[model samples]
Target chain A: MSATTAVPTTAGRRPMRGLGALTASEARLFLRDVGSVVFAVLFPALLVVGVGYALPGMRDPIEGMGAPWDGHLAIQLYIPIALSLAVATVALSTLPTQIVTARELGVLRRISTTPMRPQGVLIAQVVVNLGVLVLASLLALVAAALAFGLPAPQSPAVAALAFLVGAAATAGVGLLIAALVRKASAAGGIGMMVYFPMLFFAGMWTPGPLMPDTVAAIAQFTPLGALSQALTAAWFTGEFPALQLVVMVAYIVVLYPLAAKLFRWQ
Target chain B: MTTVVQVENLRKSYGAKVAVADVSFAVERGEIFGILGRNGAGKTTSVETLAGLRRADGGSVRVLGVDPRKDPQAIRTVVGVQLQEARLPARITVIEALHLFASFYPDPADPEELLGMLGLTEHRGKQFAKLSGGLKQRLSIALALVGNPQVAILDELTTGLDPQARREVWDLVERVRDSGVTIILVTHFMDEAERLCDRLVVIDEGRVVAAGSPAELIRGGNDERTFRMRLPDGAADQFDLIGSLADVHTVIAVEDEVEVTGSTHVLPAVILALAESGIVPDEIRTMTRTLEDVFVDVTGHAPEEELAA
Candidate 1:
């Protein structure tokens, strides 16, 4: 046997040193995935540009409500829907799938053996997904403004708050789904199953203004629907939708802890 | 040598099925200790408990003088583990995986040097999924050692590798052990245990059957040796005389060959008796009991048979 080498003692080193390095590495990996980039970062903007600019009548004002709601174009209503789509794409599809896949692959188990806990990897993943969602939503908003002359938000601060809360609620739902699913493929399948329906109720296929009263009333109860209403109200009327805010807050309060409780590190 | 890992009467169960029961062992520092068993034999459960990944249902486990159940984090800093069937992200490059794992430690080995030592320098740019089975195994070992941990628990370190690759990995493990990192290797291959392990415990059906060095275990169970040679022209008639010798246990003649099995002293005794019978034989070979023989003697079945069962 060869002589043993001298091992340096690690006396004064800190335990939580390289979480930023972990986050940076995870972000690089997230960008390397072409499918995630296309769906989470570019698809929402494409939806806005394709529907708002390519179709002529989509930019025309609807002929329903009296003065307050009159002269509102379908494209303007879609801007909030586009933002909600970005959040759902990232939170429901991208973030959960990534986390579930990491768990299935034993990546989380491998990290658990280290001095740093595996929760750091999960937090890094969430941070990267949230960053992507923000960029994607901004890109869609910018594209809408340039393509069809979409107006800026009436209250930028309230819109920003609504977006933040909406993102948190939707991401919590994603974590819940991730906690429930055991495999990456199942996470993807279940995410899409939940994503498209939530988007439908959020007025992706039919504008919220055009939905029947009964359907719109039911949509208000869904988390994404509440998010869309709050974002649209903030952008159009400059008023905070208190009920919508409460709905989103309720989703976050219930789902986040439930997901955490159900989460399996191995 | 000081004891680094101590497990006493450890017990665990999954629902109604017991995975491990009454398992106890201690590993000395700077030794390549082995836990040898078939699949589902609780070798992994025992090792995982030592690594603080699982909570034992009964008994006590102290890794590096710290109770794993009391403080898993304390062991985490000093122990590194490479779990069975665990993998890195498919899209992560080799260097990126190393760096990511390296960042988890307070004083990790240099990623570039570690990769070079593992013969992965040329494949640093390859994604994890793109690497071959041997390369993947090497990368896993590299990651396990990157933390500069005092103790490493490697589960099935060379399961799927080809013979040459397995040898290379064994060499790397020896070097790692030489660097004073105590290793607890979990494997079912008896040849691996015989070659690499200084001391080992045989776990069968969630219990330790025997524990000792390879030579000691073989001697403890069955010390019989066998010698075979081509039967000379007149030697077949005197087989009974050789079988009646003091050290000879059995003698049989089949076609052109005569086989003798007995104690270690039987070889020379059989040879002298055959010569006295005026027979000069060619093509003589001796077969000694190996760890595999010891394993079969203790477990009542071969490792492969257990795996198939």
Candidate 2:
């Protein structure tokens, strides 16, 4: 038997010291997963480049659009849509699956035994996924700007804020999925069910002013729809999408607390 | 022998189904205490309360001088838990897990030393999903000890291991106890509790039915002794005579042999009675009741003894 080490007194112990290490380890694991990385980080960039180059007539000027919408290439509408696709893939699919799997495998229950609070574990998860979302969105933005001649964000600060609120709303939906589902496999299926619909409302099928008025009214309330609207307006028209930002913020306010209350660690 | 953990009449229920009715136990410092029981026998519930993972409906639980429910933060810092079936992410390497868990504590044990202690040094770079069952269990124990906890609760640590692997884990647990951290081993294996625990409480059907050292529980306060003996060729006439003896309780002919159950002196008395009939039984095997027998006697269920070597 080896000699026992000295026992440190419990005075002034920091339980949350592991938060940084926990987040770092989670981030490393997330990167190691090639599938999650490709879908969450690199896929958006691929979408931008693929649609801009392979699809015919993407860079051609529009004919019927007037004033602010006049002379815009067809590919200009895709930048925000691609960004929405990235958020949907990560927040709806990858994030929820990881959380539910960890829960089912007792990872969260194991953390409960440590000095760190269980809430720290959830926070670490959200932070890692959020970091990945930001990277993916930026990669897509750069890809569109360089490849498709997409204009830079006219109101850069507002666009950045809009992107954040939209990401939070999407993450909120993922958190709710994680809270309701008990199985990891089921989480993926359920995420996909929500993913396709959200992408539709984000204007993946119909870009900008081409969408019907009734659909636009309904889509503005959806997280991805609001994000696409905000990103497109701020990028092209240089106008703050105040309604879209408020809608996304409302989704976050409702979804985040609801998910937290329903979240099951074990 | 200071008591580091004390539970008094702990009671808990999930909705209408009661998980723990009444349970109490005190764990002394530096001892490998056991909460032995069958599955769904309130063992997990009791320990979960001590770890502050579950709250008891009624009863007091004090871990290291702090109530687990009232001062959950204090309990978490001092006590560590390796939950049953709890696993790490499939892609996380062994070393990364140790370092991550170590950071959860104020003063943690060296991760390198823990790897060596748990015999996982060579497999440090292996992902969690690639490790064998025994290796996964060893890593779980290593993580439990990495925080330098004052007390560690290991729930069903070796439930899914081969005999050799189980023994290896048993040795590791003893080594952990030798390092001066008190262990509360919750298990369903009779031999595991018998071999590892200094003192154990046997729980059955959500209640503690027996509690003591293995030897004491086996002894069972003047328990009956049983022995089986083969009668000499065609000498069946002496079986009833043995049962009729003063000290003997019941004698039944089982197949070719006569099984006798009686007082502590039954074995010698039966032999004497057989000798009086001028029949010397060729084989007489005296049965010493084990914890298995005691468990059956108390819980009224067949003991779930391991058939491993």
Candidate 3:
């Protein structure tokens, strides 16, 4: 038969099967993408281990939270730190770069012509990123538990909630940045610029509350700082930090719509 | 028949440069419609708008009878695309790329079968970054086709390939067209367009200056024959005598060279006249008009100058 004839390749399939297919495809691609895999898993895990190992008596501080906590109490603090970096990498660097290259390669344009939704594209990205972070976070937790005696999470539900919230906030911001950047090359630069500052001010390096008065106060208002505070509070105290939660949620609320408006699928 | 793609007065600008302006076209179902233009002729911008990748600064577009901008989700499920200049991750094998893209569509082609058809079966395990340029381009096409799209948009279809590889790509494109899918081929190559397209539109300065079948265009471009003749010493005066014959419209001479512009059918008579004059030119050549020539004539500049225009 001639090539033009609609072969039975994908015919007879049920409609609306694209989303499932898209999700699977996106997940697999994310898994194989070395940069993302490294960013989501190894990078965060290394940072957690490196930072945890560097600070003596760090585990004492967490177990001192009045309860026995878990094995390596200090590792609990590092859990949120590792998770935050994973979220930022997936949302900011990995996701944005994917879209930018997709645009450059005409993948976005091709998707645009398909029955696929731009929102679906974004959904796939978030799903892949979130899934990767969850997997990596789990591994990091296990590794930390084994090596440094890191505390097992007290509240798994709260950790999950914090992860979702943190991921949502970062993914939204990353999508906005991706939409705004002109080309693929700019994605890395923009991600680094946004990432380091966010990591520093968000208390991943030092608690915003502990910084000198002016810096701490300003850091509190930054999205990362708010998100990190909220994530830490959720994982550690089991009490949601309302203000920080509001700021994190507010980042998504503003950025998601703006990103949708600015996103170029072609 | 319903229109599969429609574009109206589409406009797009980046900074001060207008990428596409007042561009419009429509593709009926199951035709290999070509968009021919020089580089930077707004072909990519126009296609991007229709593909729903870039929002138009103005005008409207409908692919598969839906507004791409308003209902991008609805559009994505039905359309299949392979973007220009896209590269898959280096670590992802060919099989991996196919599986990933196939997951995006509800019904996707079998990855193994796709690899086999695209001559990539042996390289399925190879990373995308490790493939040759031609192989990468083939992989790109395979990725586009895996979703089993109704309409396929290919930009620079045979670019960056050796002549043999280009011909192979042409065969593949023909096969795609034979499958009864409408194609919007964006290319700067005249020979490619002439060989593959049923009908085409030409863009100059962000607007379509010509549109028709390649044959119709070649025929319509002012019927005139150009002959180049190189002669020995005393052939000029004899060539002038031949030029005075009927249907010998215009003849110019620069030294021993003779250029004849007239009916191609009358060339033999001119040659016979020359024979009678005992004037035998050493070399004789005829100019057969082509799309390339028409492009030059219409734009009043060589096609090369407009490569990035």
> Against the true structure, what is each candidate's TM-score?
0.95, 0.93, 0.77
Question: Model 2, DockQ value?
Answer: 0.47
- Candidate 2 pairs with clashing backbones: none
What tens digits encode model 1's per-residue C-alpha lDDT throughout A1-266? 11122222346446566788899988998988988899899999999988887878888887766644578777878999999999999999999999999999999998888877888989899889879988998899888888777777788888888889988998889999999999999999999999998998889977756667787777777888888888888888777788888889999999999999999987
lDDT of candidate 3 over A3-83, digit per residue (tens): 222323234444444666566767777777666677767887787677767778665644333533443356556666676
lDDT of 2 by residue, B256-286 (tens): 8888999888988888877887889989888
- TM-score of candidate 1 on Cα atoms, chains taken together: 0.95
Candidate that beats the other on TM-score, 1 or 3, i.e. the better one: 1
TM-score-superior candidate, 1 or 2: 1
In order, the TM-score of chain B in each prediction is 0.95, 0.91, 0.87
Which candidate number would show the highest TM-score if scored against the true structure? 1
Fnat for the candidates in order: 0.61, 0.63, 0.39
Q: Candidate 2: misplaced stretches above 4 Å? A: A1-11, B231-237, B240-245, B269-281, B304-309
Candidate No. with top lDDT: 2
